[model samples]
Target: MTAPAELDAAGITDPALRAAYTTCRELNARHGRTYFLATRLLPRERRPAVHALYGFARYADEIVDDLGDGRPVVEKAARLDALALELDRALDGALDRAVPGGAMGHPVLAALADTARRYDIDTRYFRDFLVSMRMDTTVTDYATFEDLAVYVHGSAAVIGLQMLPVLGTTVPRADAEPAAAALGEAFQITNFLRDVGEDLDRGRVYLPAAELAAFGVDRQLLTWCRRTRRPDPRVRRALAHLVAHTRAIYRRAAPGVGMLEPASRACVSCAFALYRGILDEIEAADHHVLHRRVTVPARRRAAVALPCLARAIVARTRG
Candidate 1:
């Protein structure tokens, strides 16, 4: 459906709010290719909420990772702090009372606060997300996966938790929360593997340091491989190990797909298949993710999405 149709279906009528949601939808379409494709399968009314969530996330991520802008770490941290405060005001219904350059002035925050209020999503999830975003300005690499879990819980797992209200569920929401969080972790791990090269360029290593060490790999060795544009046997083994580890996460997340309300299932299922397909592409490339990114081919994406789209139509019709 078109943006207007989506907003109308969601009962959004305020001009400023519609504009904010439109901005978010644009962000999602431009940056979240796989995610946007899956979102197309959701009931139209739910699409704007999903876009708002993605926009909120994508904006924060760009603030942390916008290497070309050359902002200092301190500046980035301050910006995040300001964003967190603005979010608080937005959530508190104080956006209209703000001074210049405040909560009322940011479109992404506007859409997010509206969605949160509409769905009654917990406020703590947003707070936890900012906590992780703040860590990016200081923490470089994690010492172990266990240590990384702290960051991931805030950065990824809470994202899944935040979405539960919007997605609806067949069981009690708490019953599906674990699997939802697991799916988020799986997606984040897949991203860590695929973007290992780019993350290294940003002076951050997401793969656990200890795990890489087990394969006789370290930042310097990985850097050398990146610099030389060649893969090492050890690096391949390390990446292969990570690939298998990520698949385990996907397995853990699988059960939640069945727990989502029927109308929402097709969208989540399509996303699950496509995100996991990245691992297939990475392995197919012989674990050469150190120098380049891998993606599911367009044809493969269509192959997965078409069937899901049909299923989504049928589910929506039945509902």
Candidate 2:
């Protein structure tokens, strides 16, 4: 369905609200390539909410990462704080009041607050996400996966929790929560591996310091590899280990596809396949992710998505 048709199907009639959702959909379409492809397989009415969620995430990530704008860390932190305050006010019914140039004035926040209200999504999950976004301005590296898990719980895991309400579930929501969160962690870990070079350029190292240390890899070695656009055996070994670790996460997350509502299962399953396929691409390149990003080819993406799209149509027909 087209964007306007999606808004109509979702019962979103207000002009400003539709505009807000449209802005979010644009962000998702432009930035979240694989994710946006998966979302297309969802029922049209549900697509706007998923777009809102991803839009909010991508906005916050841009603020923290600055997307090569060379903004000062203090400026980014201030922006993040302002966003958190705005989000808090937005969640507290400020948007319904429609105060001039307030929380509702921001398109991404406007859409997100609407989604949160509609789904009764917990406020704490959004709060936790901001806390992690705040961490990016200060924390540079994690000592171990345990320490990284603290960051991931806020950065990644809560995203899945936020999504559960919108996606619906076959079992109790709580019953499916673990795998949902695991899937989020897996996706983020894959990103960390794929973007290691870019993240290093941004002065952050997401991989666990201890894990790299075990393979005699450190920020210096990674930076050297990124600078020279070359790969080291030790660096390749470290990436190989992390890729295996990420595959285990994908395994842990696999069963949750069954836990989703049938109509939603195909969308999540397609995303699962595509994101996991990044691991395959990385491995196929012999884990040479230090100097460049790895991606699933467009042909491979189409091959995975077509079958799932057909499945989604059948599931919706049955429902």
Candidate 3:
């Protein structure tokens, strides 16, 4: 729980606003472990904005996905709707001339509004993201890759788009958008491949249903795999196919690392390597994602991060 140095660097000096940014930073560190690690590699000045984005997303996700017993789906949907409206108000409040940053009552949204204003990020991305969060309430599985792409675009791709400003791309946004989108999709698809069991427990399956059927997998088979903790060859095959597909997306996203501002490059490269590493770990385990979560070992993360650490230091020193 170190104080967020980035908040000060970003000119967020008001005591209440700084506290709001701190709350967002805590959310990122607590729930977004991998994402938090990535933020650590960024220029300290830029980290608060990334934390704000992650916090906003995590808050909405919890509302939709972490409801306890006796909470009906309708209630969760209504809560999600409330959140979307709150976000709308928060964004509008940012434009107010009288209030400083027009921060809303919700600390996370207040921090998010400040970041959005600072970066001149489009509000449409937030609206699209809320749409996907709302989708999680009812959409359990996708019928095709095309259908799934639409949801993932809102859920994950816009996140990368939202981050482009904070990351400080060297190229025009138009040139960089495709790569950012591919990277986002790659990360989410990797999560889907690794979290198949946990997602099933939540009564959701992110894998395209058609892809599953192509490998003779269905909901029941996935449940059996989860219960048995034994690898089914067909399941393994399907997972492998997805792993390869995700790798292709990673490849598509790789060049964007070089396209980021030099000060930001090391951080994003670190993240790209680390997330892509999850795909490798999944393969090494022979695609046995149904039984347990696959993760890059801490030692391995340290190894991958070492060079980026040096690059980040150089970038900071140059500044």
Candidate 4:
């Protein structure tokens, strides 16, 4: 991945968003090697915006995951809160998203701000995204599936909603926004499941606490299972069930992709393909995320393109 750049603006301190998106061709690598071809194929105008979202998300995620600051949690939390407010200001039109088209600082958010302004995506979603990031400070367990979904709505769903207006181009709020949200939800859940061990190590648990209790899985068991060299039976079962749930989400979710204007399919296709790979990788790992995180290889990623490509081609031919 390219380095995160500093935004010329007062708020967008991360620039990786701009560097990775200088070419949509690079996004496939940012998400995974399997997604490049499809990204190259996105709706021309919207691909850059999708790249902007990816970069934005990467920047926000790094705030929690970087682990380099070596500061007290209190300090980190406060910093994140301030960053969140800045991001909100950028969204509310109070500040620019970047240095400016011609300005200095961070090229990414600047480019992104331009992208957001050109489209009609709201500022609220960006604010919600910060809230989701702040959750990393202490939110380890979820009380229920609904609770998890609600959190996912803010963290991931908002990212999708932010991109809808960009994809619509002409109509702006076109038919795909809901589908985009579904896509975001599907991706985030799959990510949580796939990164069980990694999240656990961070002293964060993303699995539903209530569900884990019902499953007879406790925190100690979760810790041991995740820290081990191989996944235990309980972890395997829980992960498999989660993958199955993800499949269901995808089923409900895929329809939203089909609802988009044909031009927008590539954006959905690339993002969908990456998460689909995660689901597939989870299955291949025997749902053993407690043992290790699984990733799709390039060859398989290449295969992912065929189905989507053929579908896109057929859609265009028919159109």
TM-scores for all predictions: 0.96, 0.96, 0.97, 0.81
Residue lDDT tens for model 1, 1-319 = 7999999999988888889999999999999999999999999999999999999999888889863247899899999998898888887762344222224458998888888878888889989999999999999999999999999998999989988999999999999999999999999999999999988989999999999999999999999988898989999999999999999999999999999999999999999999999999999999987888899999999999999999999999999
lDDT of 2 by residue, 1-319 (tens): 8999999999888788899999999999999999999999999999999999999999999998756248888898999999998898777763455432234658889889888877878889989999999999889999999999988998999999999999999899999999999999999999999899989988899999999999999999999989998879999899999999999999999999999999999999999999999999999989877778888999999999999999999999999
lDDT for every model? 0.91, 0.91, 0.87, 0.66
lDDT by residue (132-197, candidate 4, tens digit) is 877876677788888887679889888778867755533436466776788778888888887888
| Count of clashing residue pairs in every prediction | 0, 0, 0, 10
Show where candidate 2 strays beyond 4 Å. Answer: 67-69, 94-103
Comparing 2 and 4 on TM-score, the stronger one: 2
True-vs-predicted CA distance for residue 4, candidate 4, Å: 18
Q: Per-residue lDDT tens digits of candidate 3, residues 241-267?
A: 889889999999999888888888888
Error of 3 at 145 (Å): 0.6
Residue range with the least summed lDDT across 10 consecutive positions in model 4: 1-10
Q: Lowest summed lDDT over 10 consecutive residues: which window, candidate 2?
A: 94-103
